[model samples]
Target: MAKQYDVLIRLLMLGDSGVGKTSMLCKFTEEGFNSTHIPTIGIDFKMKTLMVDDKKIRIQIWDTAGQERYDTITKQYFRRAQGIMLVYDITSEISFRHISKWLDMIDEGAGSVARILVANKSDASALRIISKEEGQTFAREKNLAFVEGSAFSGDNLDEAFEGLVKIVMDRNKKDIDEQLQSIKLYGSRENSTIDAEVKPGGCCS
Candidate 1:
């Protein structure tokens, strides 16, 4: 049979309420955003397929509610996540400051998933409370890819999703290589056992 390539990557978007987590996902998947506050109730999921490095990657993105009360509810999705987009509002300093707490929750729940730091609402440059340099520095400190994007104007939104998919694909490739090596080792051991089990005439006793 011809080799089939199907890679599934689960990604979670997290941030305080009104940080555009849902809007970002909507803009990325549907190419549009809503102006009203349609608060996510529990968890909303969307899937998109992309070609990364010539491989088909199915991205399962989970848009999580930002309300603190839903923290426990959202934690369930983090366990199986491959990548996480930590989002913050550029115009909300309080939201920006709470990033560490959110990261802590992810660490405790999701282990060591690949992460990207997203600064949303780039269209509101006039009311920006967080600087790009500051967000970049924080992302670097946390070892995350940084992206300042606007879901409203649709600027740099594609790059954000592309960047995340690239990271997830790279990690998946490494994991697959390791698994192949392990399978090879196991096969070799099985072959050795079969060789020893054969008699001089290749007949079993």
Candidate 2:
């Protein structure tokens, strides 16, 4: 049997309410964005396949409702997530300030998974409350990638997603390489049976 080349990466989008999480997901997955305020009641999900670094990656993106009551329900989706996007509204200082709590939730629920911080609504420079430099500094302090994007104008939205995919791929490659090295080291021993257990699901599903 030939080895399969399917790679699934689960990504979760989290942040305060009205930070454009749904818009960003729609823009990335379908290249469309709606201006209406149809808040996500529980969780909305979308999937897209892309070629990243010559590998076919199936990205399962989960957009969770930002309401306080949905925190418990949202946390359940974090365990298997390979990457997370901690987004904030660039025009709203309150939303931008709440990133710490969101990060904490990600850490507590997602086991400190790989994440990127994004400042949305970048198209409105005049109403911007969080500057690019500030967001970049904050992201660097937390060792997370940062980008200012706009789902409305489609600025840097694709880059933000592609960047996350690259991160996931790199980490997955490193883990596989480590396992292969361990196998090589142990398999060289005499009369040793390599009992490898393959998991049913990939990173996403």
- Tens digits of per-residue lDDT for model 2, 74-144: 88888878899989999998888899998888889987688888999999899888889999998989999
Per-residue accuracy of model 1 over 73-190 as CA lDDT, tens digit each: 8888788788999999999999999999999999999888888899999999999999999999999998999999998888998899889888876777887456446654553121
Clashing residue pairs, candidate 2?
none
lDDT of each: 0.79, 0.79
* Candidate 1, RMSD to the unseen true structure: 14.1
lDDT, candidate 1, at 89: 93
Compared to the true structure, candidate 1 yields what TM-score? 0.83
- List where candidate 1 sits over 4 angstroms from the true fold: 1-5, 176-205
Instruction: Determine which window of 10 residues in candidate 2 has minimal summed lDDT.
Output: 196-205
